[model samples]
Target chain A: MDIEVIKRYLPLFSKAFLLTVKIGWLGIALAFVLGILCAFTLYYKLPVLSTIVRFYVELFRNTPLLVQLFFIYYGLPSIGIRISAQLCGTLGLGLLGGSYMAESIRSGLEAVPAIQSESAKSLGMTKWQAFRYIIAPQAFNISVPGLMANVIFLLKETSVFSAISLMDLMFTAKDLIGLHYNTTESLFLLVLFYVLMLLPVSFAGSLIEKKVRFGMYGD
Target chain B: MEEILKVEHLHKSFENLTVLEDVSLTVNKGEVVVIVGPSGCGKSTFLRCINGLEDIQDGRVILDGQTINPPLQKGDNYRQRIGMVFQSYELFPHKTILGNIMLAPIKVQKRDKNEVRAEAEQLLEKVGLSSKKDNYPRQLSGGQKQRVAIVRALIMHPEILLFDEVTAALDPEMVREVLDVILELAKQQRTMLIVTHEMAFARAIADRIVFMDGGSIIEVSEPERFFTEPRTERAKRFLKTFEY
Candidate 1:
C-alpha cells in the first residue's frame, strides 16, 4: 500500500463513483421510458411516428456507441448546440441502449399470442384495458430476462463515457494510471469496482427470472 | 321466438383468399345451433368474425338489433354480451383459474370484487373444479382448462355463446369431459353456436345443425333430418365421411 497514492486517489475515486451512479441510473431510467413508449408505438405502427421510430432504432442499433457519443459530444458543438460531456455521454448511452430495449420489449409483447388480446376484448375489455391488464403483465413477465440482460449491457456501456472526459469510474482509474503509471493496481481496482457495481444487478436479474418463469409456466 | 343474433350476407377474405362468402344465419334466443364442416371451410373464421376478430368485407351481424363489425372498439359491450370459447382454450396462463374467471367481470365490467368472486366460485363449482381455483392454467389438463375457459365466458352472462371447434384440440378422453360441459350448457338452454367434428355430440345437443363446405352454408336442418337426409350432396358426403 503506497500511503501517498491511496490518500491522493481516494477523493478522485469517490467523486468518480458518485458521477458514475448518477449518470448510469439516469441513462437507464431514460432508456426504460423510451423503450416502453417507443415499443408500444412500434407495436401499433402509429403512421409517421412509427416510421421515424423504426429509422431511429436502425440508426442507433447499427452504429457503435462510441461513434454515437463522439457524434453527439464533438459533432453537435460544431452545429451550435453545445452539450457537456456528461450530458452527451448519458444521452448517447440512453438513446443507443433504448433501441435494444425497445426490441426486447416488442419481442416479449409479441410472444404473447394475439388471441390473448382477443380474449380480453371478447371479455368486454377495451383495447387499452386489454393491453394494460392482460397483455402487458404477461409481456413483462416473459421479457424480464432479456431486459435484465439489456440493463447489464447498458451498465457496462456506461464505461464509454471515459472516451469523452466524463469522470466515471473508468475515466478516474485511467487518469490515475496516466498520472502515476500504476497500471496493475489502477486497472485491477477498476475491475473490482465494476464487478461490485454490476454483480447486484445480474444477481437480482437471475432471481427475478426464476420467479417469472415459475409464475408464467408454473411447475 | 325472439332472434338473438342474425348475420346476413357475411363476406370475409384474407388478402386474395376468400374465407366466408355470402354466409347468412339466424339464431333464436335459447337455441343451440351446431355448425359441422370439414377443415378450412371457414367455420372458425365465421366464429371469429362474429366477435369482430376478423374484418368482414361486407355483412351485418345484428345482436339485439345492434350491428357488429370489425374493429369492435365501438361496440365494446358486445364482447361481454356475446362470449366465445376458442379451440385452443386461450386461458390466461399467467392467471389462476379463479383470476381468469373473475377478470372480465371485476376488471372490465367494474363490478364489486366480493360479489364477482362468489359468483366465480359458484361457477367453478358448477364445472366441478372448485379445488382448482388457485391453480394456474399450466397445472390443468386440456379439458379442465377448456372447462375453465367456458366458465370464464359464462360469468359474463352472455346472451349468446360461440364455440369454435373447442373440442378439436383435446384428446379423446379429454373430449368427453368438455362435451359434457357443453351438454350441460345446452341443457341450461343458453344460446350457443357450436362448431364441432363430434357428430354424435352435435346431434345430441343441437336444436339444428348447419353443414358447411367450401366457405358456403350447404345445408341447415333439424338434427334428425341433418343426421339422416342432409339436403345437399356436400352434406351427404360430409356426413358419410363422419360415419366412420
Candidate 2:
C-alpha cells in the first residue's frame, strides 16, 4: 500500500533481480550440459557410468533443493571443502535441475522409435552420425516442452538462493520487509520481479513447443 | 556369374531360441533373390544379419570377398555398401521426403549436396513421388513413405539392397504401388534380397526363390519351379495356403 516504500527499495530490488537472473541462467546452462551428458550415457547404456548417473539422478530428483543447498553450503565446509555462497547456490540449482533435465531428455530420446536408428545404420551411418544427425534433432524437438518447463522451474528455484546468503530477489524483499515492516509492498515487488524473470521463458517455451509440434525443423 | 554377397554358415539365436540356424546363401551381381516362408521363419532376421544390424552367434557375411558380419570399427563404411528398407518404412518423421532420401548420401557418404539432391529428385520421380518431395513423412501415406524409404536406400548406391517386407505395412491398395517400385528395380537388375509374403509378387519379381522353414532353408530354386513344383513338403504346404 505504501508506494513510497516500493519506490525507495526499487534500486535494491533491481540489483537483486539482476543477480538472480545471472545466477539462475548460469545454473540452467550448467544443468542443460549435465542433463544432455547424463541422458546420453543412460540412453546408450554406457556400462559403469550409467549406474552412477542413475544414482545421481535419483538422489538429486528425490530430495528437495533446499536440503541439497544446505548440504553444499553448510555441510561441505564442515568437512573442510569450502565453496563460495554464490557458487554454492548455482551448483545446488544445477545439480538439482540436472536430474530433472536428464529424465526429460532421456524420455525424449526413448520416445524416438528404434527403427529410426536402424534405418540410419542401414544407410551406412556411424552410430555417432546417426545420433548427431538423425537422433539428436528429433530427440531435441521431443524434448523442447519438457526442457522449457525445466527452464522455468529452474529459474523460479533461484528464490531459494537467498537461503544460502546470496542477495537474490527474495533476499532483497525479505530484508526490506524485515527492516521497514512493509510486508505488503515487499511481497508485491517479489511477485512482480519473479514474473518478470519467468514470463518470457514461458512465452518462449510455448513458441518453441508450437514450432516443434508443427514440425518446423523439417525441410 | 560374379557373386556380390555370400552368407556362409550363419547361425543366429536369441538367447537359446534359434532364429536362423546354419543358413547360407549367395547373391550374384544383378540378381533378385526373394525369400518366402511362413511368418517367424527367420527371413527378416537373415536380411538384418546380412546388413550387420543383428549380431550372429556363428556366421561370416562376405561382401565383395570381405567379411562384414562382425563389422570393422568403420562399419558405417561397410554398411554404406549395403542399403536396407524396412517393413514399416521407417522414414525419419522429422525430415522431408527429400531430406530423408539425401541424408545418408550427404552425411554418411559425404557426397555433394546438389548432386545427391538431383539424384534424389530423379529417384523420387521414378517412384512417382516427386510431388511429395518437400513434405514430411507424416504428411504422406504409408505407400508414399515406403517409396521414400526405397529412394533413401537407392540413393546410397549400395552394392546390394535388402528389403525386409517393405510393403507388409501398407494398405492392400497401397501395396501394389510399392511392389511396382521394387519390380521396377528388379527389371533394372539391381541386386536385392527381399523378404515378403506376397506370393504372386514374389513369383513375378524373384529371379530365384529361397524357401525357408523354421530357420532353415528347405529350398532354393528357380521361381517357376519353386512355385509350380516346390521341392519340399513344407514348400508345398506353404504354397497351398496361397491357393485361392
Candidate 3:
C-alpha cells in the first residue's frame, strides 16, 4: 500500500471523474425526455407506437447492461455503423434508464383516478390539454420517488461504461492498479469514488421527492 | 314557456343490466324539477344523460331545443354551458376554490381574467364561501367543498344547473348549509334539476316533483299534490315513509 502511488494517480482520476459525470448527465437528460415520451405513448394506448415502445423497453430491461454496452460498442462496428466508445456508452445508458423510467411513469399515470379525467372533460378541456394540465402534473408528482431511485441506479450503471474503453472512473482505477500492481488500495479508492458520485444523486432525489410531495399533496 | 330540456323514451343499459328505461320528461325554462326515487332507480344516470356525460341507448334529448344525440361538433359547441354538481363534491382537489371557479370561464369561454375573478368572487359569496376562496378542496369540510363545487358550476353561467344529491355526502348539520344555498338559487329562479331523497327539501322548493321507480317516472305533479295525493300506488307507498 504505497501512498505515493495513489497520490500520483490523482490527476488521471480527475479526468476519469469528468467523463463519468458527462456520461451520467447526458444519459439522464436524454433518458428522462425519452422516458416521458414513451410513458405518454403507453398511457394513451396509441396504436402501433405503444407496441414498439413496449418492445424497446422489454429488450433493454431484460438484458444485462454490460452485455448491452458491449453489443453497442462492438456489434455496431461489424454492422458498418462505427461510433465513438463514449457515444456508445451514452446511448446504452439512455436506453437502459429509459426503460425503467417508462415503467415508473406508467405507474404514476395509473395512480391518477378516473374521476380526475372526467372532471377535466367536464371542464371542456381537450384530451391533450387535460393530459398536459391535469394528468401530467399529477403523474410527475406520483412518480418522482420512483424516478429518482432509477436515477441513482443509472449512476451506478454508468460504471459499465468502463468496459468500452471510455476511461470512466472505474477504467481509470483499473489502469492505475495495473500500472502500480496494488489491487487493494486502488480498488478501495475506486469504491470511494463511486460512492462520491452517487451521494449527490441520492441527496438530490430526496429533495425532489419532498418538493413533489408538497406540490401534489401539500403540507 | 319554452322548454329547457326534453327527454323522449331515454333508455340506457350497461352490459346486461338496464339502468334507465323509456324515461321521458320535460323541463321548462326557469323550472326546477326534483327527481326522487329509491336507490338503483337511475336518477343519477338520468341527470348525467342530460349533460351528455353518459350516452343514452334509445332516445333523444333536446337541450334548449337542440338535439344532444350526436357528439357535439368541435368548437362553437358549448355543451359545457350546462353545468353539473355531483354528490361527491368532485371539486378539483389540486386547485384552490378560486381556481376551480375560474377554470371554466377562462379556459372554455375564454373570458378575461379580471372579469372572471370578479364573477368568481361574487359566485363564491353567493354560495357563502367567499372567505375560503384560497383553500384547496382537501382543506375544506365536505359542506364547504360542495359549496365551492356549486360556485364552480355556476361561474360558467350555464343555462341550466343539475344537482345530483349534492348534500348526500354531508353530515346532517352540514346538509342544511348546502340546501340553503340551493334554496337561494331556487329563489333566484335558476333552471335546475335536483335529485334527492330529502322529502321536505323536494316539497319546500321544487316547482315539480317527479317520482321515479324501476327507471320510469310513475308520477309527475306539483309538489303539494305529489306529496298530498300521490296518484300512483308506488308514489303513495314511497311518500308514506317520507311523510312530514
Tell me the docking grade of candidate 2. Answer: medium
Q: Rank the candidates by TM-score, best first.
A: 2, 1, 3
The pairs that clash in candidate 3 are none
Relative to the true structure, candidate 3 reaches a TM of: 0.91
- Expressed as tens digits, the lDDT of each residue in B10-44 for candidate 3 is 99888888998999999998899999998888999
Badly placed stretches (over 4 Å) of model 2 are A216-219, B72-76
lDDT of every predicted structure (CA atoms): 0.89, 0.91, 0.85
lDDT by residue (tens digit), candidate 1, B84-163:
99899999878889989988998878899999999999999998999999998999999999999999999999999999
Q: Which candidate tops TM-score?
A: 2
Off by over 4 Å in 1: A1-8, B70-76
Candidate 2 lDDT over residue span A107-198, tens digit each: 99998988889889889888889888888888989888889989999999898999988999999999988898999999999999999999
lDDT of 3 by residue, A1-219 (tens): 677867877677878888998988799888898898999899889999999999999999999999999898899999999999888888999999999999999989989887676666666666666677777777888898889889988988988888898899889888877887788778877887888899988888878777657734775
